[model samples]
Target: MGGGADDADCGDAENKLGCILSYNSHVELCVVNYTMLAVSLVAAGGLLEAERRLDPSRFGRKFVWQAAAFMAVAAFQITLCFVVNCSGVSIIWNAVVAFNSITVPGDTPRHFLFMYLLAFAMALSLDVYYAFTLELLTTIAHLCSLLLGGLGGFMYLRAFPNYGRQLRRPLLGAWNGDGGGGADDDEDDGSTNSSTGSV
Candidate 1:
């Protein structure tokens, strides 16, 4: 009977340890994700600014500037990730500690959700800007890029399936390829040609 009690105590201790370890791991991942998201946001902003300053007629030059901005952002994000790794702290812990401690008054989850939605909104806005400036081929490429990022975000949000549902609708339109305006315009021209048969 004494041995049974000892075994039960040991089991409880083991479970507690496992829980602590899991929580720590979760925290570290949160930190890394948050950092990456933050860096990406900065990069998106730079790209937007560059896009805004670009001459509309200078498509080639504009693409070059945009690409340069993207490279710069990618470099910064990579460097930040490397620095976090070198600091001997788990990136997950960075996320866990920051988010838990940084809550607004009244409702933590709601505030965090709003923050995420705002990030999504910014990304979507960038996508719209890209769509407007890029040629059809480039626009499709950029859309694909956004889609992949959205997929990754969705997977992350999936861990909190209930909360993830709230984010589902706003992100849906982000993946939609450029509107069919170009196609419609082309169709109109083709029909006109067929009707006239000379021009």
Candidate 2:
């Protein structure tokens, strides 16, 4: 009756993520959806920050690169939702599983379970906070991240050369070189010559 795998707490799903949704083989559960949404959000902010540092021009460059990065991440997320098809095998959802494994359900190292619950609570709290703050713009941004993340995973199968090549070509062609949509050619010209004209 002490610290065994068959303890009642060990058998409870609530001891894990407490997921409620179940679709089918597609997404099939709340765990995958929750993790994908979280991942897409994080990836979007990282992309925007990277672009801002690399090309700090504020005029309109921010708009173009920011948009593409969000869209690409979105596409990847969406494809992940539908195509991944099973949360049981999902890398994202299994993060919870792995964390939960830190404490055997019926074992004495109960602090790990406390840590997991604390982390989950904090994540859910932030989700609620952001949900209340979201508006039309951010909502669309979320949807686009879903679509782009999905597309990226899809293209991973086909092995595309660039991230969101199609999105960047049309949206950002005017801002960069490679002759208006470098869809067909490698983006580098490898020239070191520089000249300036003064009047």
Count of clashing residue pairs in every prediction: 8, 18
Alpha carbon deviation, residue 110, candidate 1 (Å): 2.4
State every prediction's TM-score relative to the real structure.
0.27, 0.25
lDDT of 2 at 97: 25
Whose lDDT is greatest here?
A: 1
For residues 1-199, could you state the per-residue lDDT of candidate 2 as single tens digits?
Answer: 0011112122234422121123232232334455544543443334334333333454155445435544543344334434422112122322322222221122112233344444445444533443465334333433343344344435432442322323333322323343222323323211211222311
Worst 10 residues of 1 by lDDT: 1-10
* Distance from true location, Cα of 179 in model 1, Å: 36
User: lDDT tens string, model 1, 36-112?
Assistant: 45644443443333323322344354445434534543444234324322111122212222222221111113323
Clashing pairs in 1: 27-92, 27-93, 28-91, 28-92, 28-93, 29-92, 30-95, 31-95
